[model samples]
Target: MHIMRVIVILFPLLLASSFTDACLAAEVLTLAKDGNAKAVIVLPGGATSAARETGGILADHLKQICGGEFRVIVESDLKDASVKDQRIVTKSTEPVETFILLGEGGLTKLLGATSADLGPGGILIRTFPNAIVLLGPGKTAPSDPYGTRYAVMTFMEDSLGCRFLWPGELGKVVPQRKTIKVAPINFNYTPRIRQRRIRMAMGLGERKSHGVKRLGFTDADYHYFNKAAMVTTSRDGGWANWHRLGGSLRLASGHSFGYMWEKHKDEHPEWFAVQPDGTRDQSRSPDRSRLCVSNLELIEEIARDRIESLNKSDLNSVSIGPNDGGQTSFCRCDECRKLDPPNSRKLAGGGPALTDRYIYFWNEIAKRVTEVHPDAWLTADAYSVYSAPPVLRKLHPNIAIRFVGLTYTNEEKRRQDREDWDAWSKAVKKIYFRPNVLLAGRRQGTPVIYVHKLAEDFRYLASHSLVGTDFDSCCHNWATQGLNYYVCAKLHWNPDLDVDALIDDYCQSGFGSGADAVKSYFLRLEDITNTIAEQQLKITQPFPPAVIDELRGYLDMAAAATADEPDASKRVAFLRSGLEYTDAYVAAFRIFREHEAAGGGRLLKETKQRIREALDNNWLVSRGIFENHHLAVNVATVAWGSWNYFGRYYWSDPSPEIRAKVESR
Candidate 1:
């Protein structure tokens, strides 16, 4: 295999002295063997922050490797720079040898370009020897990024040895031409529980958890989470991060979560939700709050605006609506009552009528989105109040219903949890009536609580008829913890994957064969940690101190299991210390719980003292094991305890200073 290397070299002195820095910078980048060198075209269109930063980095790298005069053109300049034959002109007087076309698909379209355009008869005839096209980090048409990039890279390497670099570095390659396998990938609707397990097991990467929220209707916060997903997905090749038109529009414009509904209510004050005293409801932000979907015009206008804006982004898929929680209450205005005659029967305390309106409104929105972006995918979040089996209007075949299952409270509450899932599943079946539904799995409340149920749900969903699922355990709230991200990645790719085996693989990859025994001990430690952090903590009622002691003994047994390892003396010591630490913490938790249950000034003082002691002892143990174990253990301790401690103060009526102290630590 012949590989053509383009070495870009930089002259710092020339750059410093140039008056026309931007233009001169362009001219200085041309290849040394003017006529012998190939023509290179670089173009960048609408870019996300990450894409722009990456472009700048690539440009800098090129400058350093290929020092000389070079002509650089932006995507906007393509039309003006083209000749009668449609070949892009080279500013250099010398004939070009290689051509590099860089930009997103939108910019490429402007150039009247295709992958085949780099061929002999196509445009940029003189620069056919070497041509490379760069995509983007911005939200783009799904097919262009996934299909186009793969196709172009293969074509470029075959036709001209020029490689494409955008997402990141392609490491050392063997010279031999080996056969490659290509698989067809699609996003089918997966069950919610399965999605949660995969995502949780992948562990919190940068923005994975946010991806889950984005999959719901919280578009405003999607970018923050998407950044994290992009980094993690790129590193571990399970799936590529997708950019949708509707999502991109919301992100770029900084639109609020429920902006569409809010805008309508602002124009018509009569559509606002009314309170018992006849005053307009103002529970959340009045300016950008939800509106009554009673008025037909309001719904139409919102649909039109959202559809048009999304179409402009050139995206083909998007998840619609807000975070899946709260009651689906709208308004009990006269127009709403007239539109919904059934409201008369369900209007007890004016609650049912309001709830009915919200369902009607959401179903209408889904209908409109399907109409506008027919080829695009639309996911309606069947979460919170919308989980029940209400009459959903007909939808386009292309639109997929996503059932979002959130387990925040105790997992053992089968009655409530099953009812929630049954309601959502029933509603989805009523509307779509197909097994091709996707489940958006989320574990709300505390991180520890969510992770515990998430694992159990993953196994449960995997046994059912699920198309695909998205996991959201790695969010801003959970990133600080020592969750097993590698395990999560494995589950994402295949939910039936054995987590223990995955952990073993991760340990081997991170630490070589010399540390196999250490890896085995850590894997065992992880199982123990999950058992304590997830399973044991779920019991609703308080346990006796003896029960706590029994749990401590079990942890001690786990520690003892590793004592006989011949090659892991250090691991054995660390395990013993961890067991001691857990024992002390469990004892402290029992005391704190007892005091908390009793309630009062004495209990408050005792709780504070218990926390102080636990923190002090744990901090010391953490320091001692810092060099022996992975950073994950320490990070998990902080992440798991941070929210738990803080929530105790807010939810359990602890002193204000308790939260402050935990936050500071």
Candidate 2:
């Protein structure tokens, strides 16, 4: 088994190295001085969405390089003729300069490459002087033909120095070269991890703060997600809308306890959770509300409602959960208690661990639904009190356990996570990790460079039976969080890629003349967080006055470096937006400190105004109302926002209470 594992790992490396050597040693293809080549992008017939999208991307990039002209030939077009003969002959009877083989199927069959041998998301790019063959695992894999698209993307990145940093047109960085050059190239790659999902914050009237544009995320973003199960308009349009571009419409929780109780409490009191007094209570708190899962009738009703709800849309996967809060909200009914054993060993949350009962309930629903819709996948958040793996019974293969991450480096927390993940990996077929990097309220200032820590965590995850990762990377504050966001996106595709070198590429490519200044700015801020700050505190917490001043100086240097170049100047402006937010935050704290020290002074008016302005600015930025694209929800107010930035900043109508008191005096 160990020998087989080594062979599997070394084969791709050997193939890639051989290709690279061959390409480097010989230069057979040449771009005519006239800037045109007899080249065509040949793709699979009756291609899937991934094939069509990738075919278009190859055609577009080829056209750009070939002075706005390139042909795309589908395999169906060459049905009667030999593909080899067609490539060697053209309508003009002149020798065809290049034949760019794309996708799998008839086109790849001409090259004798099969889907199974290529494996899932595996890609092979072999560039001859005259012909370039690109192959991706074909249509058999529905979730991601990640190979073809990632091949095209990596080709552009390696040869053309192009990058899709985040999403949308604005996030893409295309080089300003005028002509095409031909070089021998051979590359074969397969993603180390299977699933890479980024679950951003989304809802009605909410503007996406980071990554893609407002109301739309293009196919470009999907290229970064190979095994992402989240539905999108580009593919799964029935349950999803193009408004937010992409997100899920599946059931999040089995029962909305508040809504259920309001309707059924009086008529069917037995359906409600029985309190310690043996009678049912109808009250609901933010976190403490749950239904009696062990009620046989209740479980039956849930299964019926779930199937009905899922049938409304064609989405294949559903993420079901218990209530909002942690473990304590679980029903303590006699039957419910019979399902869960009291585990004093649980560390994160107290009382009985709920893994057994939750798993049992979820498996029941999954089994029933899958019987009807055989491909249906039922996912549950193994979080809060239910974070531990079920010891009583093995999980159904159709059921997926999603373990949430509270802190990345917390030893005890991660140790518990390791145990849970290892156990679940053995019991179930799929396991997903959702770690909080941005939403955890860390303020490492602009360009949050946690490449070291994130890279470390991802490497560890790859060794385990990690099928997918859903990073809760909400609020794309490019100025402060841009580096972190880019790292997160890149690492998802190839976790073993060198992170520091990637960081250097980002700094130099994104900010040309200001690269050195920007690199210094990010590294210095990272130094403070990694060295000075307490691990327990968030990276977003306010630094001391001296640290704030040091940060301001870094931004000042960055601005000066990019003063002459217009493009770099624009990029520097993005870095400055983060500085502006931080400055306002520091000023607000300073004013409050002075007011408190003086015991009521004229400074009260200024302090209130600063905080109010900061709040208002943050709201505008969060909604994409501001001119700057690289803005974040003011970290100062994230605690109050609670993942609802728009609500906290806009509709909540919160006012400075200190102002009211000062005015009253």
Candidate 3:
């Protein structure tokens, strides 16, 4: 009665319509009150993939709540369909007693909302006793159609207490109910950051042990954002651009160096990076790939390949940057060196700063690409030695600079990162962020958790013109840094969100009764990471004996805290994995030291016995973490990589025991 009494000022004339009159005149739509109520999902005839997905998502939840009474109908087809008992309705012009509206047309028609009212990725939700309307941003914005989808997820999470922790059944938490209830409500939300993405590396195959594979695009994994690492057509036929949708049109990354190397290495060796020795260097760089940035012909070749990709799809941008890895892979030829400013940060002998040539090369390439794709963008990374902004010339407006995340634990490096962000923000018109939170290759040691720092960074950068974010992580990092991963996603979506509240929600939802233990565990890990960073110690370096013991003690405490919660064993195991990994490495290093102090015989036998115990514990930890062997495989790689440092002395020996194991492998 109250809702009917209050007329929406702008919609007075529209209320005269039968549908509006019925909606305003009826009491609230009682879903499943008599077990005859049905939710009618109404969609535009040619809706986007996101619209279809969001509609289905809402319908599925209604079915769960209303006990299987729901119907999905395209708006155009609604005329032929029966709706005698339809309670929840979406975007209908016909005079319906109770109706819900979603997206642009519904919001503008029912609530008198203009396109300018909702910015890109913004949503408006208003509720009456009998009706609800969920409005999302315009469809043209890169994140668009998907922005409405995100609104759906946010609604479920905020109102229904649904939590999608990670991909897969284990990570989804949905509340069960026989009847869905709606209360009067009003809320609006807009993402602080435009781009929220995750790039995971390991396997694309259907390996059960691979977390990324298990998570897939949906299956609980895709519950968060719009972009992913791979590209494919959605089931609804709309584009699914995982990495910078409307941007790069490729499944793989770092093509520039590889393409030039493959095309010119044999015939045009000079087109590759020139070593300090005046010889062509194609193999010995941080990225194991380099390019002759000064070669105009080589730039043309790279541009041509990009054009080919653009022709295949209507991608809004392309990446024409250095290969993945540190930026010490630039050419050292005299012509390339001419672009370097004096007092440049040198790489190898008589070479200029990597930034000097990187900007010049990209500027040249951007010029050519802009001529064709004027509205499109060209992306480049400011990483490692080239992390600093260019000193000489400003980047072109068409160029997008991705400021890769640098050291988080170290104070000086953190300051340098902010400096880089500030300088580049001023120099480049478009900016995208790629934060590395992985401990891959030799950097694998103690797991680092920089939750506070990550939140701070996101908040700080949101003030700048940040277009998007792609969080780069290894397989183990994602599982081990579970809390950090959750926090990062929330911050990217809304930088102003209370991070402490998010962290609390994550620990409670993830660990349940054992939340306190898990929360303390991560806090301790962050403390140790900060200490290590402050001491200027690399995680890959061997820990001091006392530090190793302290870490082991923390692991024991975490294990004890979750020991009683057997149901949460998987989560607990994943949480403890990084520590376990570090502990195993420490124990191995200790054995190596013992061997150094004493020759073979009894010491070797005893150490081997201890190592066997450690290995056995590792398998349990692995199963508890990933429920499979991928983490074990990753750990094995770390061990073998460090074998020469210690493992070879014992594991590789020709003695009977070692020889038998080696031969079996």
Q: Where in model 3 is the C-alpha error above 4 Å?
A: 1-41, 44-50, 61-108, 111-116, 176-180, 205-255, 281-288, 296-313, 324-329, 346-352, 368-376, 438-446, 474-479, 540-582, 590-665
Error of 2 at 80 (Å): 9.3
How many times do residue backbones clash in model 2? Answer: 7
Winner on lDDT between 1 and 3 is: 3
Global CA lDDT of candidate 3, please? 0.57
Kindly list the per-residue Cα lDDT of model 3 for residues 1-665, writing each as its tens digit: 32232222112333343144434354544444444443455565677766776777766655544455556556565544322242334344554443455565532354443335555666665555455666676556554445556555655555545565554334445555665555444556556566666654444333322322322223233212212322121121121121112222221224355455555678888777777677785654533467777989888877877777667866677788677654344566788878778877654454455686688888888888778878777878888657777888778888777778566657777787788799888998877787665443323434667788778878888888787776675443444555565676666666765666676677676676667766776776777677766886655444556765675565566566667765355666654556666665566556555665787455556677666555444333432333342332244334334444434434432245533553465
* Clashing pairs for predicted structure model 2, backbone only: 29-129, 442-539, 442-540, 443-539, 443-540, 446-480, 447-480
Weakest lDDT window of 10 consecutive positions for candidate 2: 236-245
The whole-model lDDT of each prediction reads 0.37, 0.57, 0.57
**What's each prediction's clash count?**
37, 7, 9
Candidate 2 lDDT over residue span 492-517, tens digit each: 66667567777777777777777888
Ranking by TM-score: 2, 3, 1
RMSD of 3: 8.5
